[model samples]
Target: MTTILLLASLATLGYAAWYLILCSVSPWERCRRCHGARSHRTAIGTRRDCPRCDGTGIRVRIGRRLLDYIRTEYRAGSQ
Candidate 1:
C-alpha cells in the first residue's frame, strides 16, 4: 500500500510539475506578448478581451484555468 501510494504521489507530482511548466510557458500566460504568443491575432476564442496591444500586432494570451486543476489535486491530496 505504501509503495503504491508513493508511486502514485510521485506520478502526481511529476504531472503537476509538467502542468506548471506548460502553463508558465503557454503563449496565453498572463497575456504576455512574448515568445509564447497566442496563435490568434485576436482573442476570438478566449473568454476575455484581447490584450491591449492586439491592434498594434502584439500576440498575447492569458492562460485560463491552467493551474486550477493542479491546485485542486494538491488540495484533495491534503485531505
Candidate 2:
C-alpha cells in the first residue's frame, strides 16, 4: 500500500510538472463560454464581450506566467 501511494504521488507530481511546462509553451486558448466569438448574449438580449476574456477571445497562459514568475524569482535569488 505504501509503495502504491508513493507511486501515485510521484505520478501526480510528474503530471503537474508536465502540465506546467505545456502551459508555459502553449498559446492562449479561447474562452470556452464564448468559443472564440469574443462576445456573449446578455440577459437583456444584447451582446457583450466576454467578461472572462474582455472580448479578446483569449486568456493569458497561466503556466507561462507561472514559469516567468519562477524564472524571475530564481534570477533574483541568484543575484
Candidate 3:
C-alpha cells in the first residue's frame, strides 16, 4: 500500500512539473474543434471560422489560464 501511494504521488508530481514547464514554454494549444485548421468545412463545401478558437486555430492552455488567474489574484491582493 505504501509503495503504491509513493509511486502515485511521484507520478502526480512529475506530471505537474511537466505541465508547468509546458505552460511556460508554449502556453497555447491547437484548437480541439478545428484540429488547428482555423476553419471548418460545412456540408455545402463552404468554410467557416472555427467557433471554438475564433479562427485563430489555437487556444490558451488550461494550466496557463490557471496561472494567469492566480497571478492576477495575487497582484490584486498585493495592491
**Each candidate: what lDDT?**
0.56, 0.88, 0.97
TM-score of each: 0.37, 0.74, 0.91
Tens digit per residue, CA lDDT, model 1, 15-53 = 977766776676443334422343334446543334554
Candidate 1 TM-score, true structure as reference: 0.37
Worst 10 residues of 3 by lDDT: 42-51
Candidate 1 lDDT at 48 equals: 31
Model 3 residue 27 CA deviation (Å) reads 0.3
The digit string of per-residue lDDT tens for model 2 on 1-79 reads 9999999999999999898878867758878879889999999999999999989998877777777899999999999
Candidate 1: residue 70 Cα off by (Å): 14
Question: Whose lDDT is higher: candidate 1's or candidate 2's?
Answer: 2
Residue 74 accuracy (lDDT) in model 1? 96
**On a 0 to 100 scale, what is the lDDT of residue 56 in model 2?**
93
**Which pairs of residues collide in candidate 1?**
27-36, 28-61, 28-63
17-61 per-residue lDDT for model 3 (tens digits): 999999989999999999999999988999999999999999999
What would the TM-score be for candidate 3 when compared with the true structure? 0.91
- Candidate 3 lDDT: 0.97
Give model 1's clash tally.
3
Model 1 segments beyond 4 Å from truth?
A: 29-79
The better-scoring model by TM-score among 2 and 3 is 3
Backbone Cα, N, C clashes tallied per candidate: 3, 0, 0
